[model samples]
Target chain A: MLRSPDLVGKSQDSLREAFGKSLILLAEDYPSLVVLDADVAGGTGVHHFRKNFPDRFIQCGIAEQNMISVAAGMAETGLIPIVTTFAVFLLRAYEQVRLSVAYSQMNVKLVGSHCGLDVGPDGGSAQCLEDIAAFRAIPNMSVIVPASPIEINQATRFIIEHKGPIYMRSGRSPLEECLDNSYKFEFGKGKYLSRGSDLTIISCGVCTGRSIQVVKDLKELDINVELINMSTIKPIDQKIIIESAKRTSKVVTVEDHSIIGGLGSAVAEVLSEYHPTPLKRIGVKDTFGESGEPDELACKYGIDQVSIKNTIINWLKNETKG
Target chain B: MTKSVKSNVNYIRSLIVSSIYHAGSGHPGGCLSCVDIVDYLYRYHMSYSFLDCDNVSRDRFIMSKGHCVPTIYAVFCDMEYISLSELKTLRKINSRLQGHSHRVAFPQVEVSTGSLAQGFSFAIGESLGLKLQGYSNNVYAMIGDGELQEGQIWEGAMFAAHHNLGNLCTIVDYNKMQSDDLNENIIKLEPLQNKWESFGWNVFNIDGHNPNQIREVFSAAMSKENQKPSVVIAHTIKGKGVSYMESIPSWHGSVKLTEEDCRKALKDLECTDNEIEVLMSA
Candidate 1:
């Protein structure tokens, strides 16, 4: 296990910035590494890569479908093309990603930034709560949601080295750094932050940070809860989840996505298939997200640290009483 | 055109007709319409060796209008990419030849593209990729007149031209007919040449069926001094050789061909009885 980074006094950083910086560093070693972006180069933070490596960077304008298919084509000729755009806009080219990238099994990395309700003020149209479900359904496609700037940077290096199709979702706002400098990202493994026997809190992406904070508070209250940061949603860490389910006999999944097919649904599928345990999935119900502050949206959507803490406390109390 | 090349085109047309007829389903009209252009590229223009399909610097062809891929399968069979016997197994259970192009099953296919307007973008990328690696090899992509209604085609046109991808060439099979009606009736693409020019491509218009015109336009597009992508607007009939299927919009997709219909189509292509027997047996 990697040592946890000190949470206090550490400035937050957006995952998009980390992704852009990582691409520039990755291009140093991988000569064939190329980055393609839609008109959202600035928004997705690939503008940093473009300024440094203009020869390797392609501004694909506002056309996501073309960017995706072009990335697939570049991949065909032994190039690693990382395509980026807003999460919601990426779905506009879903068929291109499905057929050209995923179906062909091309070595293309798709980075969808500004995912989930955290993309505040852009409202329901911009927030992509279903992206996780949409990408997970495609075969040969690996889905990863990095919880912090450090994790996103690690994921960028990992995906550049890994072959095949991958979709990594990142948030618009800066997130608290959760992983220490020593954390190594494995493709299908979840990082265990805290171990306890009473209950397991499975989470991913920005919610993982929030869940960890909540779990720390619960520990002081004598509520022993295990926190598992499940970054890889597809090909999920089934062993860790099954073991945790058997150990705790109870599980709760939190994500800044739709409850139907995001991390919660993924955990539920595993537990139900292997060792059935009492499970609770905390995420947005099937509904659109309205314009609001990112923090306000997180609380309203029931993925905030306070809501998670309350839900766990209530569930644990109910179980103990029964 | 040489007598042998003419004969090869006819053979490819026959293969397309027979395979679609045998399968009892497929887009025959578009397949027949685009056969000559595809044949011209594979026979005269493309640089891939018959034995080694993995040549990195070899010319790449993307069938953007992939539903009409029976024509490409016929050409591939002639090229010996796959056995001629496999043509009979098209769209069959566990067949390598899927209903649409399957890149996994057929490694020679650069990308699996049944979706319209997407393959053209892939070709643009391949051209860019080759260019970035300092390889001067060309990439050819074929699109249907009707498939131009898709917005992605214009997006690719803008990107390819903006990047000055001189090695990228697009052939629009301007067959006039689409799935349900003429392209004009579905969506007006008139002044199409100007639209491509405005999008920054070197546009060439030609009679799609004329072998000499096809060769000349391709040569001119390749040898042009301009550093822009080229799009050859090849005007073609919906169905070129077969009499009853030609220029008919309803024949855009599958039209059930009776045994007599197959016989007449083959006769129109001047297929010998022995050739017909071989195709039927396969």
Candidate 2:
């Protein structure tokens, strides 16, 4: 992942840090596992793996296109190479991922750090808001966006085990752990953080933590809302979403990415096709994010706890199915 | 005195032209330019056999300039990887042979390449993987002069050199012609040999059309003595064997190969009446 220089918060708190730490644990199980980087090892959080397994760490300089295809080639030789870089920079080699890795059906895993507006202060260029849409468009590509560090750790192990081309993303901001030690990552399944019957709040990535906080606060106000952590975006957890929608009759989705073609779009597609419900998508409304603090960007984008709570209160009071 | 090699090369050239003509559309000039290089590697230098194809340790070939897949098709046909009848179905609907390399459709292809410079990077990766796994297998990739214009080529070049990929040998079919026009006119890559050498590569300049030179250079490049990747700049005509299409930019897959054109091109390669009939019917 291409990471922007300088950090306002402690790097250890971010999902990328956990992703980097997870690689070290993964190295013990998979000896043939290699991590390819384009000068973003520290930013993408694979530095721990680099220090632990120098032989398996490939420093590919700043050539993303070369790194991706090279990983595809490595996969052909029975070595699983995790191609990690910034989400936006990975788009630079989308063609390579599509043809060599996905179309070839090579056993390669793609990890993108700083997936959304969670990449604070780096400005609009560094913040990759469209990666979800870009990656999900390609066929044979599995997309995963882990909500918390705990989920990313579990998700990392799951992606390595599931052979084929997969794209997993982590936010740049530090997120509170919503899942505990008993958490086990499942394929195409959404995890319910809390249960309720008033309304369902579906979220992924950094938004899941914020939605969880909003759910807790809403519970205090007697407006109980169920929270669903949608980690897998491609083969989405339609069963959980439809069931929640059926129970609550109202669904609101949130993410740190663009409202179009992201978690919101995917949820809308599933609900409209399978279970019709009153749904509202809470995210950046088709606009580029500027250089701002992490919390400021979240608040301004309407994905923060306060914004989500206010929006949900209004929607719950007004929105009704015919 | 390589009698069989000579006849096999001619037949490969004939297959390339006839297949393009049969499909009504295919890249001819670029494919013909790199035909001898691919044929020599498959026959003399590489351990790639049509018989024991499943051997992973066998030397691998990556056609980075995937638009020239017809070259690999013709070479594979001569090697009996696929039948002559299958070769005739190239670029046709429901055929395994696509306009470019599609590994999903044709499992024989190592990597699907139609875009430029990607196959070169792929070769670098495979080279690294083989070296890490302690296998002696080498990865041979062929690119065109025009493909050097892509940024990924330089990106891969730097990576291959930085990693010191000794098991990787890349050949540039420096025919100097792209789809629209000449390389110099489109994007100049002059002082090209210097570029590779400066990138820490073992560079060699040779005539791509000469069978002996192509085979010898590949043999020499297989050495891990220098512990560096090697690049061969094979200066060749855009269309080497087919006289009607040689050294001309328009023939660089931009023009369709009609039945008359195919027969004329096969005659230039000195195919006998029986050989020509066999190729036409197949």
Candidate 3:
């Protein structure tokens, strides 16, 4: 029952930092907890965990594949090993994660930091736009993308308590705080920040904050839109998504990832199979991202609040005319 | 080798041949090659009972070369983890004994390992965990010479050495042959002993088929004098014990065993008619 801080208009905090902090807190209770990093402790912000719990922290040097398998082995021996590295680099160990962690059903926590175009100057190679899809395809893997710093902390605690393998996504830059102080995190459940009747905006990770801003800005034009944070991308909250789609016959799915097999594709699968609805997926189309500022990349990739606002406005106008 | 150890080795070889023959497909060559080492580990080396397979203090064994799991399954049967009758259902639908080591199907297995090189890493993690937990038990991982081609094996080697995991012991069934061709033709794993030594392991090269040599090497590996991880590079013939299959790459995987083939293999192991009858019936 951790209380979230008042996150409205406050200075943002890094989700990666919160991940390290949460590990410190979790280690206090679970002695079996261990942290492993692949030469990215400073980059992923697990340096705090390393500093605080030196004995509990394992620094695997520049080997993502071995790090994952080592974590799997640790989990096999009844220890909870949290493995952190750059999201893009995690793809190098995709087979290891699949066979060693997921197929074995080991209780290893995989935290992929600096995900998507938000990695900014690190460019297309560093940015991990396909991690969610890669991990989501693996059986027994729970894919979670925390919307804000507070949600990241909550998700961290929730994953440590919940058993089995998990893949959690975090960003490099500080993200806008969105959850209220009383917000309680739930696994595989979506939270509606604002509700309206015109249409529903579904987003996760950093994009959820931008979607909330888009909803607020559209309110000036009397364009009432609902904002839902679909955090758990794998075991996605389909009940809330279907209900939201039924209420507002249109949907817009946004994420700071590739539109092919990410949040957009996941929602599309749900809607097409269970409830057919007119949907517009607002995220990176089939294209590779370039090096730029975080905000600049978001805008260029059409995932920022302004892009989302314009896309919805145009979609609404067309839908009404049709 | 003691009389009982010799009997155990022969029984395991018989089981491996029979299991693969019944399944109509499996890596019989590597399984036969690695059976002697597996037998030594289970029958003499490892410290655990069948009734208490989940004992925390028990030594951990990981078969990294997962295709050769019939040898491990034979060891498991000897340990009474599963019935001899169940070994007949090796790759059958819904059988607990999967084609490879599956943790869910067989909880006694340290980790599920089929996709090569990954299991070695798991062994490293387990060794690290054991050390952190203040456990005195050693962790043993077995890999194929061909599996050394996978990059993760080197990565695990580096990590184990870096961590100074003295409690970890890795065995490589250095059979000259791989699936399609000789290891030298496909990937030269020669200077393999030097590779492990440079990675900071107490490397031991031994005749894998000789149970006495395997026992001596394992004992040396377990000695408290060594401060680094140990890897026993056991030189063995692929498809050992079976004359027709020995040193043959075609026996590496999915060898369709005819009645004559089965008889020839069992006869090579010197199985009696009654023993062959029981094996075939199962």
Candidate 4:
């Protein structure tokens, strides 16, 4: 006797469609292209590439380590390889990525599905909240966190053309469509959803949508905040971050990963080295998550909009006190 | 080839004994084993220059078995890739000739290969990239018999075969011993030729220490017209030159070169003080 889950939301299906659309666009564009997935193809949204080009698609069947090494070899042999699996599975192949791909500077794209506590219900083992932080630690790696389905497709296209090792973190659930076919996408540029001088909210991936809402909620209290979508985590738009820090002088970094080494740390590293602005970090505080709903986990880990806004308000108050 | 064989063997043997004696530590067993193979490859089979080591279009040789680098340093010194005087500085601090071939220190070397199962992939990548860029150069990767156990080596093998990478040739020093133990006891890799042939590779088996067999097998591998990747499994001894150390695993990484041992090896090489003076001067 299993409980039937709610299907009332319009979000989850959009993520699936967005991921599929991106793969289709990639296959249409690159001739020397191939996709490799472990057993979880449907979960990773690589079914579109499998459907369109069965011959080019490789189902490596539960061997993530072997899949990554083979992908590196394929990339060596001039095939653009896109490998997809759960975030934990990607970590299983991290050593392969480090030596075989990154050390050799091979062009292979790794797509990590079900990233963060957003995975929900499958528990701490399945969800990979530490993925972005772990991936950004690797040198010469480009980390992309797509906010919505539209960005997932765009990120895929951009990664295909960018010519380096790419890690695209795709969420299990979806959000409001952030981009359209008419919308332009750039690799290393952070998009500004809102502009203000009082405080800057720099975030990426699913956290970007929440950070936008946090700014909106704060505006009702007369706190104007700038919102930045720092999607490319490595080779990050450091100039934009530095400029935002200098202009606002108050910054709040938010993400769905560990506060120790994720987006918060990346931003802090940039500011600590350069501007040294007043900053508040919002993310999981050095702890593993448990089985729960996505929103419930967000609340439990203080990842919701109210907590983000509260952190910003407290930072401002603390700076005034000093 | 026949005229240079006795001299090359004696020179490589003396180099192995002296270099290890000077270094005080090195994998002498494997290096002594692979000298004739490397000698035949560089002297007669492969095309390159000793004068200008920076030739862009020359064939590339990668030492996948980096622990057995006494052979490479010896051959390169014999061919003047570096000075024989520099050879005296093997395994010393700040020496160009380290325990492994580093591309940063040596320009002519292709990939820095201390890590196993990776050199083959780099060689394949370089070969494919060179071919794609319209360069008429060949890539040769020399992998040790025991190192074939690495999974990435198989991946490289599959990629090269599937892509029909004719420009790539891999040679295995199948000495049947690795690291003071028999390879079978560690990881059994038998019927080696069949294993490679099934992997869609054109396989050749040859007595690795025999100069004529080494050259003939390399030529046969190159003659495959369909341009498929080829593997030449060279059957070799662990330590071929020194009678006391030959085929013995204990001598793999241990240094046993006393002054008496050096004198004995030098006497076996049949060199005069004039040749030693010439070696020292140039």
Candidate 5:
């Protein structure tokens, strides 16, 4: 349990620092634990783990394919391995992750750092906007997107305890702290950040904080908005999503990923399959993002909080007209 | 711990031929080539418990050359992990014996192997995982010479050596044949031993059919430290036992067997009356 001081306070760096520290601490408890890095230690924030556990940390030196196989072999020997790399490199070993870790059901943790278009000015190639959808399609995989540093730390702890394989998404930019340390975090449950009846906004990662802001802004306009932070994408909080679609009759899904297969698509899957509601999907629409500031990209792509607010208002007006 | 070395290679040849003939649709060429090498590992120098296959610390074996699943399956069945009756169902639908194996189908299987080159990586991860957990168990991964054409296999090879994975052992079944042709005509891994050695492995070359030589090298590998992962370059002949099939690329995978062909292959092994009865029953 974390304290209020630990709440909504730390940046992504701080969260990753804490995660590295916690990982080193966990090494003491489980000596079988080993950390692997694919040349993104400082970027992914696992430098601390490398520093503290030099003997256990395997630096695979820029080779993503080898890193994946080595990690798989390590897992086969009964050790719990945590791998860190950029989203693009992780995709290089997608087949390895799928066949070896997921299909074989080995215990391995893959931390996809600098996910989405949050790598600031790194541009499209460096930014991993499609990672969420790419990993979500892996069967028998636990997909997690932590909203803030607090949630990142929580997800870190959660993944270590949970059995099987996991793909944890980490933000390149520091996100606002949303949950206090005392907040109870579970793997598959959606956090109902605020409650409203008129409309529901579902989001996760940095976009979750943005969705909360949209809820606040909509409230000022007398539009009672319900905001849900969906942390787990696969085995998504379907109950809340369907319930929200049923109550609000209109749902706005937001994420810093492609609308085709990311959070918006996941939410839409539930709605189309069971609850058919009018949905406004907020994401990068079938196009790669350009080199710009994280905020600029979000605003330009119409995934910012303001865009979410405007879309919800328009959807409401449209419903009334219909 | 186990030290298994065969004094004679003839026994393995006989067994491999008999098994492939019985199964009818196995990768006989590759399986024959790998038989002596695998036999050496199982018989000579690995510390794995046959009874406690589920032991977390027990040594693990992975067949990266998944098309040759029948070979390993036969070896395991001979070792009594499975019954002979189950051996008859190789490649049959709704059978534990799939063309590739899954642990869900068999308890002794640590990892499911069907897709090529991935098994080596899986073995590497599992090996490191065991070592990280403070377990002394080792992992043995086998890859086909042809399967090395897959990019991921090289990735696994490089990683294992770079990490100085001392408890890991990888064996290459250099039968020199691919699915449709010889490895040289395809993608040649000629400086194969040099490549592995360059990537920081303790490479050993052996006559793959000679079980004793394989056992001795594996034993040496087990005792060494401060070295990279070890690879035994087992020089083998594809379709080792049958006179006509040996070193033939077409036998890589096929159902070329008829009753007459099966009888001829079986006759070469000098099957006993009791063994003949067993085969008939199966």
Candidate 6:
């Protein structure tokens, strides 16, 4: 079951909404679990957690660095703190994350909502395109991007149990379901959504959701695309990536983030190191996004299905010529 | 009690002087300035001693200005949290005592902080966490006056007061000098008391080096009847006891202390022959 039965009829739900619900649900089991926000409760969708657990929810006003710093302190007192904000703004405390959380190896979960182009009309400032690069660069920090609302639910629970520092991104735009309720989210593991031999499309975050549709559509056209959801960016699933790439021969990496230092780069690093394979990284090409509809931005930024299809089509033509 | 505090403070000063002087590089200027306040808290205020950390009903202390961690090691050694031999390994390779305090290296440090203002911010969170657990124990953090220039301090100032965290107390060692130069040249923090008051903290002004004043100020800050966060601004010279190092910007940190420097520093703190031998042992 690619899609959860509960979300079968539902057309769309934002990743942040599922993240907030998962946080509230996880709080019952882990009493030490607390949520900290930088006055972005509505944006990051933690207002429900704040409302339900007022004693546990700490509103740090508009100070992101303080929110991060304080969360590190909370972690020291045997409490698990999830610090939330828009992805781009999370970098404002990059130094704090480096020192207080990562360098110190504190048990703090950093959840950045509004990741990448899905941020839509809010533009480049709000869209957190560089968080994957920023967080994964730190030695002790793990980066996770959930493919859909179901993945977010599972990933949120996984992070609460996982100790040390982690950066998990949630989205503002509605994400279609990709994983069923039975799906278990594991750190540093990739999921094989569908299988084919023509070429592999390794995608992360919402791109994984879209790639599911692309692989299905391409199967009808006899292209036979292999789709793997590479959600965990840092400590990436190297085994799955190499195996899928070797079987398919050619690999296309897709993400809602930039081409540099993201899912594309992670896959490229793995393939280029151990298994040399022809690969194309499909994402925003070294440019800032602008104010537009998410669908328009997706097409302009070349992460849309039509753009990925055109790329795969060109690659197939090149293969025929070879 | 004041007389005992003065004597213990001098002993801790000798410990700091010997350790930093042996390490060849450490911040002694701000350490000397802030030692009395921190030393007083360890002796009279904080409930838990590092030697007896299993006691959960204890107050937490955060050293915000971490470069002066030699002073913390000195206090810990003087209080017997760690042995006098470990106190001599201030900046040694693989020593628990780092150039900047790290909790991993030394678990006695509640939070690892060399980056300014962030420790105070963490103190606010710890206070909130304790409140959530229904523990009335307080969280105390000390920041150098120059460290107050960091924006996160003010953010924490606003946050602690707004939440009415009466268990949270911040001691500002107003030694004035920063990394490169005096704070007046870097960032003027004039009307500093009014600034904290404006942020809604219960502000108390005191002389940082005076043992009696340090004790009296904390009593008012620690009073349970008050219902908001407290800030004790202890104004003092950058390097108080040492003659040449007093208010000298170059002695602020990482300045190698020669044999003569250690000898003179110990002499300045008025350490007797027996005290100097004990301080320099191992």
lDDT of 3 by residue, B147-189 (tens): 9999989999999999989999999998889999999999898
Report how far residue B43 has shifted in candidate 5, in Å: 3.0
Residue-level lDDT of model 4, residues B32-125, one tens digit each, is 7788878777877777775666565677787878877778888877776666678878888998777776654664554455667666766776
DockQ of 1: 0.86
Interface RMSD of 2: 0.8
The candidate, 1 or 6, that scores higher on lDDT is 1
Q: Is the docking of candidate 2 incorrect, acceptable, medium or high quality?
A: medium
Residue-level error in angstroms, candidate 2, position A83 = 1.3
What is model 4's DockQ versus the real complex? 0.17
Estimate every model's Cα lDDT from 0 to 1. 0.87, 0.86, 0.87, 0.76, 0.76, 0.85
Winner by lDDT between candidate 6 and candidate 2: 2
- Quote the lDDT for B92 in model 6: 93
Each predicted model: what fraction of the native A–B Cα contacts (within 8 Å) does it retain?
A: 0.80, 0.82, 0.83, 0.07, 0.76, 0.68
Cα lDDT over the full model 5 = 0.76
C-alpha displacement of B109 in model 4, angstroms? 4.2
- In candidate 3, position A209 carries an lDDT of 83
- DockQ of candidate 5, scored on C-alphas against the true complex (2 decimals): 0.59
Clashing pairs in 4: none
Could you tell me every candidate's TM-score relative to the true structure? 0.96, 0.95, 0.96, 0.78, 0.91, 0.94
Residue-wise C-alpha lDDT for candidate 6, range A1-322, written one tens digit per residue: 1223432222277898888877777788989899999989999988878877888888899999998988987787788999999987789999999988988888999999888999999888788788998898998999999888878888888999998899999888887787776777788999888889999999989888788888877888898988888889999999998999889899999999889999989998999999999888899888889999999999998889888888778887887688
DockQ of each: 0.86, 0.78, 0.82, 0.17, 0.59, 0.69
Report how far residue B167 has shifted in candidate 4, in Å: 8.6
Task: Give the CAPRI class of candidate 3.
Answer: high
Better of 1 and 4 by DockQ: 1
